[model samples]
Target: MRTNTFLFTVLVISIPYSLSADSFTFFNYYHDHMVLQKSSTGTTIWGQSSKVNDVVHIQIDNKEVAQTTVSSHHIWEAKFTSPSDNTPHTVSAVSSLGTIHISDVLFGDVWVCSGQSNMEFNLHGVLNATAEFADSANYPNIRFLHVHRQYSASPLTDIDSVDAVWNTPSEKSLSSFSAVCWLYGKYLSQHFNYPIGLVETNWGGTRIEAWSSPDAVRRCAAFGRKRNQYSQSQLYNAMIYPLLRNTIKGVIWYQGESNAAHAYKYSCQFLEMIMDWRTKFNTASLGTTSSSFPFGFVQLAPWREGEANLGFPQLRWSQTSNIGYVPNGLMQNVFMAVAMDLPDFQSPYGNIHPRYKHEVAYRLYLGALGVAYHETDVDFEGPFPTSARIDKSTSILTVEYDRGLHPIEVRSYNGFEVCCVNQTTTFCNAFDSHWINVTMTSHSFASISLDVSSCSHGNHVTQVRYAWRESPCAFKQCAVYGKMNNLPGPPFTYYVH
Candidate 1:
């Protein structure tokens, strides 16, 4: 006979932990201290059962709510109206063979946060990490489910592994959790005074195509038949497919560096993926039918040095479908966090990953409050050009801005550029462009005046752009910003119109 001894260190004090998956067990996402979406359309509970044709009863607070028979595939599912209240409740699933119980279950808004390394940047990597970790225990209602990274050629019905169970925020659990997801959930918890669930499903060094489905990629005309077979749709098969049956509030994404080389096609591919996700999520048996759910993302952060002509600026433009802002003509029900000013050249991880995740998450929360929750009091976006024109009489280009709830602050007029049209060709090119000086308007307070006297060479200036470079300015020192919110103006290039 052989004997084995084991020692365990318990970090979660409230959860009644269980690691065994038996004849009747819920999916990996449902467990103690888990949160289900509080939807009027109802919520679905599913699990695997060995006994086919056997009935399984689902109860809340020991009161029977719904029941279903086990299918031939050894699976059982039951749907019921989820409670809107955020208070904890006890849930149990009973069968002829056994009974499975999960305590501390809460009904609340659940968000899926997905992307590449930037979204995978953990809490320990952010600034003031120790202080943040110490204060994490204060928000007990904010929960997290960190999905283990995986890739598959085909869709998965269930997750292969879980990095951590549905866990309440703590130093131990948050050390490796997504920083952007945690901070955004913390903001929501404080504002709504309720439970908030965040699902972290992301991988490092992955392109947008890998996160998108094959059907979505094929819909993109730019990638119709030229898509690479190695990594295309692999991450989505394993990571996102298994969660299609789960209802979610929205999604927050932070990716794009890996696809910078093919930045020109990003607009087509990204938009198609968003539409595909909305359509699929609406049609799924257990997912929500709200097809226009809010989607938010972080724009690429500045990188000091990398491949030449890597198209970071172009990729940033492509992120917005070349519109320079979300909720535009190209995309709706979407928002973005401008990260052009956050350049972290000394980060231990790499120059591409910035350490200012707290600010990014805060901005994302503001967008959620406005776009998702439909709160009109908060300004979710930074300053942007509402209109522009060149004063031929004064040789000045006055750009009017729609500063959302804040006044424009011009720290330095560094990134203003004017396209001087060539005399012979009657067309403007980058070679003919030159840096221009700009000043704050004393009268409007939301507008800037640029000196375009030097741009006249038998042809007047035809275009203008700002912060159109890999590293636009020093860290947090962009030329334009929102004075109160401290949000940098998004990078843009547009003709004078």
Candidate 2:
């Protein structure tokens, strides 16, 4: 009887502790020792732990940052400033009562990589993924924090997937890396060797509104009141809100499929969202702005009419137009290895997924070279037209771009036809005729000169549009690297400078 009672009593006490160790109870284990990593060199983190005899040991980079005892309420807290460089650090608290360790601790540039299906597409789906994942091995220095998908009006402090490890690439877990982000990190890691952290937070079918906060959407001029429907900040509540105060390099965004039909709104409104994100991120004493955060991203890849969206085509054009509004350093850079010669642009036109994610990563690498690493000679952008001159009597149109490789091929995509401002063009108009052509054939000049004797005049002599009608994405003059072909140029709106 004595033996039976003694055994029963021990079970009563041990059960709670064991369950706490293995289960998700009593404040998410993730939240219990919630880590606040790299706020600002000027800021500090403070929190409370609820337990008795708890010996709280605060750690950074796997070493002790601070330590203390739990109060009567069994709670404790700590504070830290931003890290010195792009180095990863771990933060946690282990009490006599329990233990907590957060994975993929990083101190360097941390960016939230988000988007829809393409953004959600993982490393495993990309070509050479098996080899890349295997060869890259585990990157203990490059950490990744993935937020689980959840819908909620109020923000959540403790999310579903915690203790997320920033392990190196491998066949088993590499599939989780957003192909774009993984490749981006590989390029940055190889060049900088600074700790790189990726916060993977994206919903497969999410719209731009879904990823934004209610307040952010409300502020957008285009969303108007309708934005309220998906604008309650549900995503940030589940994703961004929970990871507040964690410093970041910038955001790599790859969305817009849901609202592609509304690219016009996206041009300005989307940049507004970028402003919002930067405002939120920069809100910290950390004070990092999107303008300065190195927010570079992919301009969507080339896709044929049938595969993904049937026959619609304005979406891609809208994205190209928006690039003009995106801040200089933070935009769709075309000069790099992004879409140059991607498989999607080639023969197998049916596959919607561009499995060669490495190319996307390659583009990002170019962006980092120019942005984060501060390399000036990097070429990851496209030509910006600075001025234009129209000579009606001479039948010549001279156009100058802000930047270019020069002697670039000019044409209407799918053989863009030239027509007069009065009459619509015929099939013959689509092909280059006596009216439209390229001139001044040297690569050294910054501007391309074309003779338009055969082309149509626009609303006035003051304005002469080139290929003003709908056009395809095909351009023969892509850079030698060819990443710029995915997005065809928009019908240019020229003004004399």
Candidate 3:
């Protein structure tokens, strides 16, 4: 393998041993065109060696940097500082057994894009697939490694296999890959002008517990353990555990559809899972000692269902731990992309899977730019309600919002609803609530005034909410939006004060 010209090569003689090319090889995840996490202290490199006690040497551009002895289990790992330059370098691993080499490796940020079916949704299913595939060649530095779907009852040291190697963006490679993963990376590449790597590991119709560690799931009081093969902790064992050795910038998840039945429990379960992942990845990955890695996720999108118990709205709220927006007290260094306004009622795949993934990916990229990259100038958050108060004398309910890059644009108040309580309770049940007419009286942009005289409970109204149904309004027609960005105000339920 070629060595970097800036680095000096160190020569060492090795005695021949009873080992073949297959006996000494890098892990399946390490391959040509891969982007290693750029770290000044250390970047981890691992492989399997056939002979125990034998030393495995790792080299970047032919210069030996770190070495480690093969364990009794035949696993070996080495840590060395990876170069921060953008130029491609060759990586080589040498041992008494044999030498393995891969070409065209780069140092850059790597992100894990994971979750359920929505995350697994391929670019082929998107509406702009044709144009996207044609323009893929423009993003040669944006690459992906698609992990093959698998689940195990116990944690695995390495994955069994992958659907694809570290592949650069191409018409063929981009077509069948995860749409959100590719689009997000593409944006990063454009912004930073550096190599961007994305690891797409997700499965369709999988629950949060399936992807969460056993300890994480146990922390949720409402969650119960199951011994089934495809149950709790199975996906985390097979999918997430194997990638712990590699340092990642952060993660962007798209899920929660499968957890709708237990939406209330998600407020606790989701935070537990994020904390668990941060702990494990920080401890296992070399040079990543920080436990507060940036995490971004997509809130559940609206669907054409009338059943109040379906729990899509509740799931979205719980996604934020009932706080509405992220980076709150419950979740730090985290962000969300609200999708309630982007409903897909007639997708070819199904109503649940939206075809407008470009918007979702754009929003996710915006979050990454703001939270992960620390681009303070970028505004990604949608308009969020800060407070809601009712003026019984004026018969108007004024809701104040925290604005982002633009002021609030009150469209039609289609999703606004008021709750009249006959008895005191924690939250007004969705089934017991009814819709009321709301008209914009004042021309205020930051704070909106709604005429709520039509509310049956009148002064007895206890709560106010917007877009609180499986399908609250037509696609992209939610009541409130940003004046310029068109980012809809997120779905929220606030107590009247």
Candidate 4:
């Protein structure tokens, strides 16, 4: 009987011992070749451990950053002061279980590029992709952390996919990398001469609602039906929430194709998504105020079927008009990269995925240079019409733009259109014969004279729109450039009294 008791006791002891043998380790994000955010404070290094109350020491480049004990929950975290210089460093996390050493880590700006298929469009599919793949070896400092596509019923602490890891830019790595992100990173790295880290979290053909939190989606009454249509908060819970601990410079989004059906509600939904992310990220990382980081997004490119139904234009207007909805403090940090001129024109009907990703990336890079980097001499935004007035006697309409204007490439301005209140039809009179001579009065104003006498109705012109059509390409002629950077102007619309 005593021998039997001894064996049973041994079995009991071994059971708990075996369970405790699980080793402590760093999160998947903290891996070799990872680039931490430079020129910023409050960068965190975190992981999980099986041992409780055990100290975890973090060292960067042989210098100690901090030492913290693993909590009862088996999680450990430590924040380190980021070095001001851009250089490669090795980080080591030592615990009772073992020592995890991350090598070739870089200190530089890190950005999160998230959206649908366009953002997920791989570099391998882009034009001149072969040349780009061969040339990728030139920029070793640019690193990419690609998050595998995932969805969960509840928020997960970490993703389980093996492909999610930081990778140095190379021919092999470039194959799966986002094309727009690669171009943006290349430009920033070349211009700034520093390391640039990109966190790619996107799924092809996914809607903005799919990426948004359930709470955020529920807050908008317009999305009530949509909330029940799919698994609410699946993507946000699985993909985005896990990265809340990561410190980033900003986010560049290229979505809106899926949300075109609900174009009217997009303004509020998009705003809420931005605010929700900003609030959650800031609160999780720094416990600071909302709207703490910058956000830049690409306005939807013109699609073939969308033009016939006028869906793309409505979505574009929704995106542009909501820029002011975000608080003023954060509004200045918000940027919209226009793609009205970047769509594929060679096709009888334009393709949704434009071949010219370089132009898209260039536009985004210019915005980042001005907003995030604070380059004083960069002209990121095109001419935006601020105000307009009508002279009833001469039947002349003068519109004032924000950025200084120049003469359009073509003498004829094809984008300008007019609408009269008395018109029975809702459609604006587009490319009408009434529009005579359009002239640039100064560096900031344009004048358009209309022949009201030719109108069937005697009502004065109540609205004027430039490049506001579904497949708007007319502004290509009036591509005004800023003197600082010489980038072309974006399309605009004006309401007249």
Candidate 5:
């Protein structure tokens, strides 16, 4: 009697195990309440099934869309036309094992919010967390998929588990969602009146090398030790590669604090990273017309005071220069969200994480409005110094800017600093005396008159730096802004000829 009972128990346990092994299931991202990329031509759905070579049927809104067979590797994929209209529809996948139904899937714009700690910063950690969390229930169409942090030495086919699945924003989820991404999606959803999908992938204190492919980093000679020391392509393999097949509108990056030490090499490293992502994700589903997609990023906020060794300024310059230095054939779609004025002034000497994430989000939204959406009327950037000319007669440097810039509001002329190029030493030295004065000539112009007589190197001012300190706000009270939009002028240094 005991032997017979043991045999029956073994059979019962083996039956369910065999049945489950034969079943098919969708990728983790294809769960219910997901949002498909509406702007793309089609949406690609992929899954795995135990029954290889079996036919798989796909349907959207009960209409047959595609039919394909599972591959020898037990993997299957189907592409379905996504309607331009942002309406919710039911998606289903049927195989020999069974039929899986996904409910409440919408077609809309999808954006990937990625970076380090700032991008990973949650809504509950920002200012006015309670009010924002309570108000999040109003936007039911905004969905979020928070990709769990993971790393691997080799590329991964899929993540082991996802922290958060696709769901409409609620008080519970909003509190933990990325604050900048949440606010950005909220603004876009209100303006476009469509569902917005955000994929949050980030790791705190991670350098740019961690997010880039190993081969790409190895190609750049400047990243010598970085290529071998860190786990090459670990984050890219585990976090990004799995989602390359998914269609996305663009990416919003908010990193660089960790890469500040390697600021000189950032321009090449960052550009390579951008091109790498564009090349990998440029499939039919994600769109292939353009070699690159729109990429917007936040400039590092102010940090420690007078720490030039930190390379914050150098990193900021590299970020801005990348807007114009796109790889050949790739579209010039890079944009920057300046954060010079967004840092917390109370603890400018210590605080690196600014509490005012809403402003940062708004700035990123403005950049997307102009660069991605192509809104001509939107003034997305502050007054940028376009060209500078030095008048030998009067020793005055006049800097020209783009249109729509208002007069620079100067609390004090302290941010302006002059560096004299020493012919004998071949080095530029800061002027010892008060050798510069700034004057707002017009609504869109400014002139800095150098005191050539007071300069130590006779009239040879090699460079002029404006608000270029590590913490200009804290030390020099650097206050310059666009009168029209009230946006602060980005910190910059100019070479005088």
Candidate 6:
């Protein structure tokens, strides 16, 4: 068996325990040629090989596309992620020694999830512990590649993997994989039944900056505002850049608890990361042309509620505000499914890690189905309302949605605190829907349009909101929705919470 003994952690170097790559005990071989997106830059054929420096050649769309060099740590990663004209094409790669050859690679979508403890929370302890789970063993199609986490001050080309492989969910592997990703994958599989791959590159307790590249963040003023976050790109260099050309669906992120304190800046920086990731890959990086690059994410769930010290509500509000700042992109729909509503599931104290992981995965699934699959017929909970405009004369709050079928329904916001424009920015202590329709005085714009049918015939309405002390829209319990079934129900489909 091969082992890597590190001498110093400053550089986070890996020392070889054996000369032969296959001799390593932990990783048998990476399941390769995972995600090949349509119009991807260069096709990447990644996976573990028999030995280090094993030459790999890729053939995609009936053409030879990539060649790779294995790092001394015995890691093999290569990409030819350029997509060609949105056509379905097959890809194949063979090792020089003929030890591995993977065929039938299709160009579709791929996404990577990397962050801190919240992002790293696994499935075992959360919802359905493996002991209680059914036999959900292999989905050879939905490849899962587990990345080894490395922390250092400087940039790194590659990181070593001791254990993990591309396989379907098993009793053994189900526990280690991200509970959120599992749900997302389950949704993807059930929604489209396409081959899904999850490249788990997250680390516990790490900051968001550690996941973003130094160069990408430096371009934005928001990232520059923080001193330490800008200084390091080791994780980015080692993890993200290497996988750029690899075909991936859009991202499904679950992060931001660590950055909750600085909510305003996260709005700007988070948008930057989304744009940067798109720009790094497709020709039309910013919008739907990049297959709409469905960048959905789980809104931060209920945690640290009513805490005197922790700013849980504020953090969640900042998270929900992502819809406002990101512009046009819809919120990744989950919150309810992951059942943060279950009273027993919550920490009940100051705890960031919630036990209800199944609900988290379920919510992610609903999100993937809504965005990536565009399964509008399925009636998934999705595409939350991003903007609500109150029209005085018409007595209608014309609301435009970020996604989903047009002509959406706007209702009372669950969690909101009224901030009166009259006072000196002092917020009122109220548990009411902040955004509501007020009978406009009618001297305003005569052309304003709202979903006029839904509003009451006549009443004095000023604003609308999913109001709570925090910004997330929840009413009955600390969390808005509960139970796995309600996540995809018609009533909870498109609320602002």
Ten-residue stretch with the least lDDT total in model 5: 4-13
Worst 10 residues of 1 by lDDT: 6-15
Ranking by lDDT: 3, 1, 5, 4, 2, 6
Task: Give the per-residue lDDT digits (tens) of candidate 6, residues 66-148.
Answer: 77766665655565545534333455555655544443443444556666665677766664565433645544455566777
Q: lDDT per residue, candidate 2, 317-399, as tens digits?
A: 34444233233443432222334224354423234456767767776677667665568776654454566676767766566
RMSD of each: 9.3, 11.8, 7.2, 10.1, 10.3, 10.3
Candidate no. 3 TM-score: 0.91
How far residue 82's Cα lies from its native spot in candidate 5, in Å, is 0.5
Which digits, one per residue and each the tens of the lDDT, describe model 3 over residues 59-86?
8898998889997767787888878789
* Per-residue accuracy of model 4 over 1-497 as CA lDDT, tens digit each: 01111111010001111225557777777788888876446577788888889999999877888899987767787877877777778899888788889998988888899998788887876778889988888889999988888876666676545364788877787788889998999999999888899989888767677777765676564442343213456777777877876777889999888877777777767767777787777756553213458788887776653254555667776775533211234254677677776666553223777767787888889888877777888777776666777777666667766656554433334555556555444444433444322443333334334344333355556666665556665324343454444555555556676
Clashes in model 4: which pairs?
Answer: none
**TM-score of candidate 2 versus the correct structure, residues matched by position:** 0.70
Candidate with the larger TM-score of 2 and 4? 4
Which runs of model 1 end up more than 4 angstroms from their true locations?
Answer: 1-22, 221-230, 285-289, 305-310, 404-409, 423-444
Candidates' lDDT values, in order? 0.79, 0.50, 0.79, 0.69, 0.70, 0.48
Cα-based TM-score, every candidate = 0.89, 0.70, 0.91, 0.85, 0.86, 0.63
lDDT of 5 at 461: 66
Using lDDT as the yardstick, the better of models 1 and 4 is 1
Better of 2 and 6 by lDDT: 2
Greater lDDT among 2 and 3 belongs to: 3
> Best candidate per TM-score, number?
3
Error of 3 at 164 (Å): 0.9
lDDT score for candidate 6 against the true structure: 0.48
Clashes of each: 0, 31, 1, 0, 0, 48
